[model samples]
Target: MTTTAAAHTDLDGTLPPLAEPWDPAEFETRLRAVGEERYHDRHPFNVRMHSGDLSPSELRRWIGNRFHYQRHIPVKDALITAKLDTPALRRMWLRRIQDHDGPAEGEGGIERWLRLGEAAGLERQAMLRGDTVLPGVRLAVDGYVNFCRLRSPLEAVAASLTELSAPDLMRARIEAFERHYPWIGTEGLAYFRSRVSQGRRDSREALDLVLAWARTRDDQERAVAALRFKCDVLWSLLDAVDAAGHREPA
Candidate 1:
């Protein structure tokens, strides 16, 4: 997939001269437009996987490498949550942390992803150690987390609007796994299944907050850029994964 400038470059606090803030509906349409144009759903790696063209080596490598991104979700959410003002806002946002981390051990999305690792022929311990994670994947995911950490609370939350497009991707992934990679047990798909619903709920909540908080054209533009940056993050992560065996040694 072709990456936009938003993916590789910093925002640098630039925007055109302020105009009227877009109506909520149009602003949302614009956000969805970014996803439609640049979401990782169309990346060749993903396209190959969905079409049953991925080798077991590639699939296993991806399961492990992608776990690096999954594990940091809460850390990113926590940073954003801290930046949110008011107990009510923090309380609402904290559910994201709980959803990923869960209320106890041996649960949550990370735990489910580890089970997915097991299903894909990776050992739990090794996956936890990020044994198959490539340098580029790490850099990409870390850049995402840092974008959340350093940006405004609103922009950080805007980056999460990727969840807006996530449910369908999760469904496609589940279908792809079942159809193209049947050697993997059905149980491993729980993580993807879980995300289908989680994605909808998260995106709705996030969209409401984003629309409400971004009260100016400048704020809206920055928010859109943040979402674009996130799409690039995912695209870049896949770019790294697709390069698995071809990269030069550090």
Candidate 2:
């Protein structure tokens, strides 16, 4: 007897229902599966962008819209940081905000992102302010901040598990953008390049924190759910751009 595709409700029919509670090992497997199946690596725009198939104008749109998420990372970290009671944990978590906001004014990841914006023909000040960002993007970012505020710290850190998979993606994006958008100036791609190192370091630290502290089966389950929520946050942000009537620059 053969089962039809509809018989399986989840992305992989073989897996258990996403709503079901699970042990730590099973939860981790499902969490990683969520990344594998639904992460931005599978986003259509990303596939086109990385394959050098996107036109210059389309590339500009991606950078312009993505600036909102970039600008919100520090804000998200700030929300998480405020909940921490330990000076040591706060000190460790503070680096994520600093990485994006920079050591001083006019520097750091946010500044690097602005350089990409300028190269893409967007106004640096406007992008920095996130003025023209999509409503969905704002909703997703604010949800992330609230998730950190409302959830356990381990779960909050787990939501950032997307970073674990980002280093490689960032490297690929740097190479692809450099190759395809030569007129945009290679130096402007430094934001992607910097993420390769920063993402790996940050993700490793966050992963250690999550896995070490989330000790119960329920804790593990909630942590995985948090990660899935964060993945949706990312996925929906890109979907908003795609759904906004923007297509690969024709």
Candidate 3:
């Protein structure tokens, strides 16, 4: 039996016309376009990073602030996991949390990010203490956390669609680091390397879910919007990181 959007159920009381969901191919195309237009990969800071133009201190400042985002990923995932409707779905979502937090300390993405911090010459303790995290960066990261916490599960999953573009970005990052930022060392590239494969897998799963669950025109629009919102969050993060911090209060 074919599965498609259920009968017209207005998202709000106004009862917008019960438009058919877009064809899967069209829906996916629309989703991809959000990243094409708004993804943080286009942010000036990322453009500079990939071009190998950022000074070491500039790069270190970014890594330090980025730690908050990295560490909070599992927290947001856990919140979504709790809201997932099925055990199997929860199990699948739980893997994302584990991917970052791991079953034990000294493992997982957070640990790798810490290694990245160390390679960038930021003290491990300082990163852990959140000392170098600029106020703007903290606010942007918190915005992401609050987005996941407050949005519907479908929208939350859709937001993670940022992963779709992450693999290619990681590849470019690895090459950029190897070629231009030799001071960070091969060891520091591990996070980006691991993400190349992880991003592919995670994005495929997320895309499948978004395509399946966004069953109405409203759902589809919201999913696309959620993806755009996530992209904006990422862009905002780079904006904060790339700006001069001299005037910003601690």
Instruction: Sum up the clashes in candidate 1.
Output: 0
What tens-digit string does per-residue lDDT give for candidate 2 at 61-110? 66777887888889878888887789999999999999999999988998
**In model 1, what lDDT does residue 160 have?**
96
TM-score of each: 0.91, 0.85, 0.91
* Deviating ranges (above 4 Å) for candidate 3: 1-16, 245-250
What C-alpha lDDT, on a 0 to 100 scale, does residue 219 get in candidate 3? 98
Per-residue lDDT of candidate 1, residues 135-250 (tens digit)? 99999999999999999988999999999999999999999999989999999999999999999999999999999999999999999999999999999999999987455354
> What TM-score does model 1 achieve against the real structure?
0.91
Q: After superposition, how far is residue 209 of candidate 3 from its true place, in Å?
A: 0.9
**Model 3 over residues 42-148: C-alpha lDDT tens digits?**
88889989999888888898899888899999999998898899999999999999989977988899999999989988999999999877778788878888989
Model 1 residue pairs with clashes: none
Query: Candidate 3, which ten residues in sequence have the lowest lDDT sum?
Result: 4-13
Better of 2 and 3 by TM-score: 3
Q: RMSD in angstroms, all models? A: 6.8, 7.6, 5.9
lDDT for each candidate structure: 0.92, 0.80, 0.89
